[model samples]
Target: MANELTISGRIVSVLPLQTGTSKSGHSWQKQEYILDTGGQYPKKVCFSLFGDSITKFPLQVGQDVTVSIDIESREWNNKWYTEVRAWNVTYASQQPQLQAQPPVAQPVPPQPQPAPQPQATGELPF
Candidate 1:
């Protein structure tokens, strides 16, 4: 818990989901996502969700999310590798919902009246 950290950003990409069985014969799954924190100089971070958390957090590109992660480093073959694993993920803020507006009724123009013709005259006047 001491190594836990939180970061918020918009998801730039979603990496392919990885699934395999561990040495203990238990199936595991992991999903990685690239996040971009917009600013004068934006930062990009790659974090992963493991196991059921991957389904619980179901991420998508362009979604703004805040992730709580734990940074871990492990040594393999004399090389140390670091991983940012997200334990919790939530929308940074409530996403705005778009409301459908009712269509406006167009006003109909009034029909023009025809001019009344003068009654027929008996004869032509000088």
Candidate 2:
């Protein structure tokens, strides 16, 4: 869409799923997740997936992804509310695997030797 925006980050949390039947007798589902833009000053954004999109993008915590979102606001009961809705989700990149390194041998320190005891004298002196 013309107003769509894209953001890339790691999934910080997955909120509880919400399900209900609409007034027109149709069932709907909504799922929300938090994304953290990692940098010097990280920012957290909460976005939602609706209906089949929830299953289409089975997001998980710690998974890196780029999401296309639409920002919209509505007024209800004289108050305005805004929502960040995600339309597309793609994996950013696979995390790099760390390889194991060979262990280094440590040097052992030498133990100290004990001093010899003095011999006992036989004669008693007064």
Candidate 3:
């Protein structure tokens, strides 16, 4: 059984569908796509949609999307061949916006003290 994996990113390229005949005279077709995950350190991965799956989800380059895939490895002539196949695709918009912050309370100014009024001096009032 193939292990399932999901990844989200923008579409880098949508390669044309490829068709070929197997050694046993069977025809096979597949469509490939490259995704670039925008982040601190960007990453690129190539995945394919096989057979009828290609028509189910029509994808365009430069669009953001989340893709569900299955990982499968096969031994061919003493070498290993790995394939990442997409089974589900969902559109994803750009990063979410940050919430707005509340306004800060301003500090109140200090009030000035009233000056003292000097009445008549200790001496008798003139």
C-alpha TM-score for every candidate? 0.72, 0.72, 0.65
lDDT of each residue in 1-126, candidate 3, tens digit only: 655679989888988789999999999999999999989989999999988888897777877889998888999999999998899988875633335478899999999988765566756433
Error of 1 at 77 (Å): 1.2
Candidate 3 yields a Cα-based lDDT of 0.85
RMSD of model 3 against the true structure:
12.7
Error of 1 at 114 (Å): 27
Q: lDDT per residue, candidate 1, 1-126, as tens digits?
A: 276689998898999989999999999988999999888899999999998897788787778888998988999999999999999987857653336478999999999999766557855443
**lDDT winner:** 2
Per-residue alpha-carbon lDDT of candidate 2 for residues 32-114, written as tens digits (9 for 90 to 100): 99999999999999999999999999888878999999999999999999999999999866843335367889898888887
- Residue ranges of candidate 3 with Cα displaced over 4 Å: 1-4, 23-26, 93-126
Task: Check candidate 3 and list the clashing pairs.
Answer: none
State residue 96's C-alpha deviation in candidate 1, in Å: 6.9
Question: With candidate 3 superimposed using the best TM-score fit, by how many Å does residue 108's alpha carbon deviate from the native?
Answer: 52
Off by over 4 Å in 1: 1-3, 94-126
